[model samples]
Target: MPNHPQPLRSDYKYLQPITTRWHDNDLYGHVNNVTYYSYFDSAVNTYLIEQGGLDIHDGNVVGFVVSSACDYFASIAFPDRIEIGLRVGKLGNSSVQYELAVFKDGVEEACAAGRFVHVFVDRASNRPVSIPEPLRSALARLQA
Candidate 1:
């Protein structure tokens, strides 16, 4: 096996709790790979809604995911209470990179680590725009 860099909870600025479903497991009895991306999307967007006050349906500006990648270090199964650690790796004029780590509750090492990039753009025009003040502030708090 290859050595993986495990992430700790202290490394994250925010967290979103998640529950695993039976269907999340595959024949090997662990969560499927695709599910990790779903968790990544949920945790990041939940932060935007709960803390950044972003309106997903009617916002003038929306974030479009342009790039993402994942590295899995461990396995997670159904019935696990997952705690996702989120932090901002970088923020630019109209883009942000979010880093995520998924940990089984009570564990110190991340079961998986991934990143998502969002380009802030005008919803109607689909052109890049400055991140709104509230969104910027919220995102700043997550910066490492």
Candidate 2:
């Protein structure tokens, strides 16, 4: 196995608690690897909609996922309360890269670490556009 760098809770600027659902576990009794991506998505979009003034329904500017990657360090199972740590690894005019980690409740070390990159685009034209000021400013606070 390739050696993956472990991330710590202190690396993130925001924390979102998540409850593991019974369905999240697979036949192996651990959260399915695919579910980690959902956790990453939920954490990032929740912050954007709640704190960054993102208008998902009627906004002219929208963000599309351009890239994503994850590395798992440990397995997590149902009934485990998990906390997702989020921070901005890179912020650009039209693109932002969010770094995320999954930590089992009360753990200081991450169980998984990942990154999601979003490119701001015009909803009508589907072309890249500068990130709006409100969103940009909100993202700035998350810079790591």
Candidate 3:
């Protein structure tokens, strides 16, 4: 397997707690690999909506996820309280790369780490657009 660099809790600027659902586990009894991506999406979107003032429903511009990746370091089962640690890995004119980590609550190390890239675009034309001032300022605070 290719070696993926593991991240620590302190590496992130924002953290959001998540409660694992029973359905998140796979037949093997741990969180399904696909669920990690869901956690990443939830955390990033929560930050964008709450901190960046993104109007997902009626905004002229919205962010579309263009790429994502995850690496699991350990297993996490249902009923476990988790926190998604998030930070901006890169901020560009039209795109922002978010790095995230899933950690069991109170744990210092990550159980899984991932990256998601969002490209800002005009909702009507679906064309690329520069990130808005409010969103850009919010993203800058989390830059790593």
| lDDT tens digits, residue span 46-70, model 1 | 9999999999999999999999988
Q: Using Cα atoms with residue i matched to residue i, what is each candidate's TM-score against the true structure?
A: 0.96, 0.97, 0.97
> How high is the CA lDDT of each candidate model?
0.93, 0.94, 0.94
Candidate 1 residue runs with Cα over 4 Å from true position = 1-4
| Candidate 1 lDDT score at position 132 | 95
Candidate 2 colliding pairs: none
Indicate which candidate wins on TM-score: 3
Distance from true location, Cα of 119 in model 3, Å:
0.3
Candidate 1 vs. true structure, TM-score: 0.96
Candidate 3 lDDT score at position 24:
99
lDDT per residue, candidate 3, 98-121, as tens digits?
999999988998999899899999
Cα lDDT of model 1 overall?
0.93
The 10-residue segment with the lowest total lDDT in model 3: 1-10
